[model samples]
Target: MAAIVGSTPTFVPPHVVPPARAIKGLALIAGFLRNPLEIVPQDAYEQDYVAFNGLGPRFAWVTGPDLLKTVLLDESDKFSKSVQIEFFGPLLGQGILTSEGADWRWQRQVAAPMFRRQDLLSFVPVFVSATHRLLDRWRRSPAGTPQRIEADMTEVTFDIICATLLPSSDATVGLALEASADRLQRSAMWRQLYVTAHMPKWVPQPGARRIRAAVRALRASVGALLTERRRALSQPDDLIRRLMAAHDPVTGASMNDEQLIDNLLTFYLAGHETTSKALTWTLYLLACSPQWTVALTEEIAEVTGGKPVSSDHIDKLVLTQQVIKECMRLYPPVPTTSRQAIGDVRLGEHLIKAGTSIAIPIYAMHRHQKRWRHPNAFDPTRFSPMNEGDISRYQYMPFGAGPRICIGMAFAMIEITSILATILQQAKLALADVHAPLPVARITLHPKGGMPLRVWVP
Candidate 1:
């Protein structure tokens, strides 16, 4: 048994132990062919943490509540967000999502005021209206036919984010923004997989070109919006205006055009992708778990009573939130997080050197046997407030933990629940296929073949 820090003994599995070189070699090869990342199962009873390569000298994985606490809470400063995320820097500029250190803190402070609870309350109607539009669009589609639901969800979320975050509503710009987002995601995934294979970032691969083109298009669109917003003296109650008006309180310097564009793009990309994936997965789970779906339907009906799902109403639908939580647990959109060690550190008995790339595999952690009871089962009850006490804090971080946790956590939760409730109010959905598609690890965890479902008027 390997001696690990903390109260309990930490044992490396047989696959990770003897013949370490062989395992590393296998991972390297897989990187060239597919994604270098592998989702591993953690222990069933004690603690669940999955370890994988963090694309640098360090070997990284997620496990045990104590470990999560150390990474997210206790020793957060020891780590920094991976430089690899800078692949998005060109697209997102120095936006909060792609920045670090002082820059991140400054932008976070500026953006924080715009996302206050009161402001979010005002945006509830935007969410409800967008969802209603989506439901209406679905109703017009041919019935009993397999609908590529993922695409629809993507469009719906994109529109909501655009309406709520941007200054203008020109259909042309909206369409371009949506197209750019799609292209950027596809390109980023290609780049991530290629870089893991040890390919250079500047390689003129087809995927690389696509990514560049996507970024260019997105930049042009955002640039136009920024120009318009700046030229017009009067501003609206939206994220764009807030960002434009934001200034570093201490330095009193405002963000440049480039910074504004990047942050705006970041919000659209990060905000939409995660929310859409969560909603899609929630629908899939609801399809497979009819009992839960029916119960959820009853809850939605009783709570809203045919009213649209406002943010206030979203809170009342506890079961809907649980369903979303469970889906996120199983298929967290951002399945892995990485950080580079700023200095040498001790993780238990393991002496990790500075510059090591640490990986926190949320996917593996969610399914680890030691951390979860019946790890493979889809039981929303596990997340119930009453039942959640048994779970470790670090063991179940779907939105991540600590200071570096996702900034848009509350926004995403409200968006997902609101949209899902709106859909339930208008339609009943079923999976078009008998079996769910296998999960694929992209930049985000997505269904390989896309989520196809049959929608019928309720």
Candidate 2:
């Protein structure tokens, strides 16, 4: 195999197996904070299953491709998402991400139509326009100016979300919603990591007051918007409008204001955060691998013919898409997923007891030894047309797999490709710091401090 980009003395963290006696309460969490992949035992890359005993629960982190399929695809019903619901239900309410059983089925059906391929393709103009605006802002900062790229990506995605999902919303409300998502995510992560989930709400914890305030502000703003949209005689064709019209097919029932609010919040949080983080990490990898950036720029030029990229040109920009795919493989936004078994289940030779938390360690799986030729390296060629048939379906799940896969996968791909093409078309970005940004896992994977990249016109 050819030498992949970022294969030099770059910033890939090494996974290590902690000594038997070193595993203790909060130690794993602390280790994970230092390096997200470091917490995974080195043996997990080759092993089918690794049972971990923690202060909270006894869960098995399974890495076998077939075993992963069994959990995420084949036996999804047996492995319910009770554990995820417990972690995210408060912050997200009864949204799709937190709901299960009949409620989950109904929510998925209601939300499915809005993300269809045609509808998602219709969002291209919004994405390209947002990227242009972002570049305009960057141009004003002067050539070679150091900027926190992650925050910029977040701001750009936030704008796109507001334009496409809530066109009627103003800047002030959008800011409130953004702040609410950030606060609630941090608060929820802290609770999941350090504090007990069963702890009473009255028991004061870190960021409790701020979380409360942010949640209240977010609810009030979205509720007010819903009320105003309800009064409008004619509304624009956007997600808010579609959601307002969506009803349960089986029951022929419409969503009440609370359900509407929950779904809206879910879109805002998921859409804005995941897309921005993915872009951030992609740029980080680009900085470390300038050759791939040059290749992507050339591909963009040939596809656009030196003009602004449009929806019709999306398929022609294949290399740029591969770069984004490899970036997600290296640093998936939602790093790990855990599911609780509703009943006893047998995974291969092991018998998983009822209620056991089954962890599908996505990050580990992407880089597992048994999966790819060069799992740890940045190689977009792995996803090229000729190599697509060689890769296993379950081995590359950035957006997850099965019926519960991410609904926004298509939309996210279009958005990422557009934003990346637009950026590479005009400017060449390079890492501004000598050391790499430390990878941190919160609600989403983020660079610990921020990504500062030097932007120069190409």
Candidate 3:
């Protein structure tokens, strides 16, 4: 048994922060490139908070639950976003995720209703249909053949988002959308590094030209679709159509074409990347813990009762939801988020001065030794009915917390929960590789190569 387990490669080792010192200049950037997860020194974990004096900027890594609340939730306004995030501007434009102040408020208000419970409930069928399509394809392959689970999840989630938001797009258009987003995600890491180094956007770095081309293609495709939708005699009540009709209650203003394109790209990129990563990690964990897989499958069998999953049936899938919640806790889709102080801010005993960057290390926070018992262990029970209440509101922020929480939080949850239920109901999954996949951080956390798994009929 040890040999079978050992056959797979080592799990990506946790990066330990080097001893305290003045880490600055190119050394700082090199340290980050080596392992983004080691965002702070080992002492930071013991202390739960630490400040660093470095060349490029003065920053603090805050992991204490209360401190995170002050930075991300309570005193959020005092902490604006860091300039480093502008690396995404080329791909995301000035969408809600990147916008701030009144602009963010207006966009949120205009698009809020589209993600309400009732609206998401309407997407249940779309989720199930997309999952079934993937299952159909998987069924044709040999039962024990290795499958690239990461790519599979990415394709399915991408398809589901397109179906829900752009219902009229055909397979050809769907492929184009996928291609464009893939180009951006594949190149995002290097682009972020270049931007962080203060390199100009038009410097024509190695792959920058291709990435720019992909971004332009994506915008053009979305723009063409929007134009076509406008010319249609009647429009479907999908996300795109609804956004076109939505108006800001305060200003009574509607989103123009440019605004629509930016928001659509934001929704597509955000929703697609996070959901796929969540599903991939969930499956990997379940593969490692087959007993839990059996438990989840059994629970699905009981609740679903050999029928399709519906919105009404979702509420009863208690254990299934817990499994996903636990998976997210162990592997948050968006691993880390940072903010910069706009002015001097008092968080707990420390005074963070203006122009300082604050790292809300969500990845470290989830596994902080002081915060969660056996923080490294995989235990879905932590999120079970009886134990969930014990967790601090700020401690478990997979979709983040407070006002700037992910707008697609509800949509992503419903989609992930429904798809997990639907897939596990029809198949049993096992990791194809003997070793675990390495978790590499990019724009989102992804398995280094892909999550290879074997699918079989139970």
Superposed Cα deviation of residue 223, candidate 2 (Å):
1.5
Q: Which residue runs does candidate 3 get wrong by more than 4 Å?
A: 1-27, 194-206, 248-253
lDDT of 2 by residue, 333-421 (tens): 88887777789998888898887777776777888888766677777877777777887878889888888899989889988998889
The backbone clash count of each candidate, in order, is: 11, 0, 3
Cα-based TM-score, every candidate: 0.88, 0.91, 0.91
Best by TM-score: 2
Residue pair clashes in candidate 3? 8-434, 8-435, 9-435
Each prediction's Cα lDDT score?
0.71, 0.77, 0.78
**Residue 429 accuracy (lDDT) in model 2:** 87
lDDT of 3 by residue, 1-458 (tens): 01111122223232233446436666766766654664456555556678876523567777888888888788999987655347667766777887888878878877788889887988899899999999988898988778888999999999888888676444666677788888877776566666544456577666777898998998887887787788889887777877788776768888888888888888888888899999999998888876678888888888778798899878788888887997887788887777888999898999888978776667777777787776667777778787789999888898888799999989998999999999998987887967666666677888866789999753
Q: Residue pairs in steric clash, candidate 2? A: none
Q: Which whole-number lDDT from 0 to 100 does residue 397 have in model 1? A: 80
Using lDDT as the measure, name the better of candidate 1 and candidate 2. 2
TM-score of 2: 0.91
